[model samples]
Target: MTDSPEEPNPYTAGLEHKPQRDDTFYYTTVVFLVEGTLFRVPRHPFIDGSDVFRQMFQLPVPDGVEADGCSDGRPLRLEFIQQNDFKQLLKVLFPHHSQPQKSSPKTFAEWRSVLKLSSMWEFESVKKLAVDHIGTMQIDPIDKIGLARDYDVQEWLVPALNELAKRKEPIGMKDADKLGMELALKVAAVRESVMSSYSGYPLQIGERQAGHIDFTNAIETMLTTLENS
Candidate 1:
């Protein structure tokens, strides 16, 4: 009779990625150990294991999966859990991405940071998330005059420009008139398109422009507003 390779408890294996109770909501690394046979498991489910255990073990193990796990006694599973987490984070950050105009900010600024990081890394889904969030706003002076100038969120550009001449003047615009005017024209075009697509009247431009705004500035402002005195 041939002896079957040991099927170690996935929960006990060094390759197993169970999340600690204290780290369930945050990112946590897990280790698993299997003496002979190997298998892949997901991250979040392992973190909060409930009914998923049965489903994972039921799936047939693919060839070469064992070889990959047993190499040099240091198993590195290819489940790509980080990528999955990032993808889920994108959904949380930009829920209304396709609609553009109706999306609201997620409850936490962590979502915004995730979107920004995703954009910086050129992650397609992450970029889409940021764009969707930007599209919903009325384009405050800071976004129109500062962050827009650097980050290039194309969706907000045209609406901002359309109302530029009438909107409250941003500080130190005297030196950047040409570039400002150029952006204003682009914003006008974008605004027209947005208004045509939506049923509501266009948003009004405000007179008081925010000063010295950046991504961090926006985040700080939001945090302050959230923590009312």
Candidate 2:
């Protein structure tokens, strides 16, 4: 009889067995726990848009190590972020064409959440988008100043502060609280000086509205003086 074929090498045989494909697509799935709810989102947007997520994914996975839900075919869990905030961020990062109306956040609160989360996560593009939306919105001047300062949108600062300075009434306690005492005092003083100087006489329709022009000029002058001084 022909010599029995050499016993198949058991280790090599095991190595030769190819594992069945689980899925055709090679996308990573991440799970987030937000306010007791679980969010299963694709990892691509996070990896591409956020430096925080990029570095997290780059960490080495130890042999045989398993994460909850991950072993049971669920995404790996990410915790600590608020659900509403994460949802708002997802709306910006992965807008769906089917819901064109909801593709981008329209309200100030939603964009504020987006800005907060995107900024925290270092999602530069999403942060920029949030900033753009917030800049164009009809937010209260004092609130706009706060947002501009928080987001480093310097272009919004002077215009928002100028609007506050031009208001006929004194800045309210609530608004002053938001603006803080020093800036609030400066605005109050500028408004007082502008009204006293600009309101003594009425002008023709052809002439510049003195209150408007003078207040605008005075605000600019005050800001310039402050900068120079």
Candidate 3:
């Protein structure tokens, strides 16, 4: 047996060659307690992906006081967080490297959760991934508007607004509640303007309003102006 080929990546062979720290390969495990559940994961993702985590990690530990994530007794306690949401985030941040697709978030709600947490924690990469995934699917326009506002999803904003402006149905009470009084009134105003202009006829789905394609641009400009106000 050709002596089991050097088991794996060998370390610096000679003593004279002092071992150097490899930043590229460094990893530390951290434990977090979410909703009374313990989750131990590689610390690098948290430290690297989120400004919040990076700042938390950089804070110096007091003499003789163990870091919160160092042990079970003092694991980082994340508050106001749903354990399922945290788990969904972990599925993105700490995937099953060997079988990545196995741990991939597939459902629309799953991606939304990832987007929410990633945005909240300032994980730009994960946030982008969530945004892209959501882009591929259809979402309720009112909900999308709320998401765009809460997460600063600039691209989703105009498109969702355009959908709302161009759709046939008037905003319902529940949807109006979601959109808030100001925006609901603005949308109603837009629908009224378009309908009244079209000789008492409602705009059909996928039809250019009054045979003018500039309707979306008009809606976007109006909404942007209102939002900024």
lDDT of 2 by residue, 97-180 (tens): 328888778799999999888888899999988988888888888888898778776788888887776565567788778888
Against the true structure, what is each candidate's TM-score?
0.32, 0.70, 0.81
lDDT of every predicted structure (CA atoms): 0.43, 0.73, 0.82
**TM-score (C-alpha, index-matched) for candidate 2:** 0.70
What is candidate 3's CA lDDT for residue 160? Answer: 85
lDDT of 1 by residue, 25-115 (tens): 5533323333333333333443233233234434676776653333435554434334433433434443554255424445324344545
Tens digit of per-residue lDDT, candidate 3, span 155-214: 998778778776666677887789888888777676666543345665543343433323
User: What is residue 69's positional error in candidate 2, in angstroms?
Assistant: 8.2
Clashing residue pairs in candidate 3 (N, C-alpha, C atoms within 3 angstroms)? none
Q: Give the lowest summed-lDDT range of ten residues in model 2.
A: 202-211
Model 2 stretches with alpha carbons more than 4 Å out: 1-25, 67-80, 97-101, 194-211, 214-229
| Superposed model 3: Cα runs more than 4 Å off | 1-21, 97-101, 195-214
Worst 10 residues of 3 by lDDT: 205-214
Error of 1 at 76 (Å): 14
What C-alpha RMSD separates each model from the true structure? 16.1, 7.3, 8.0
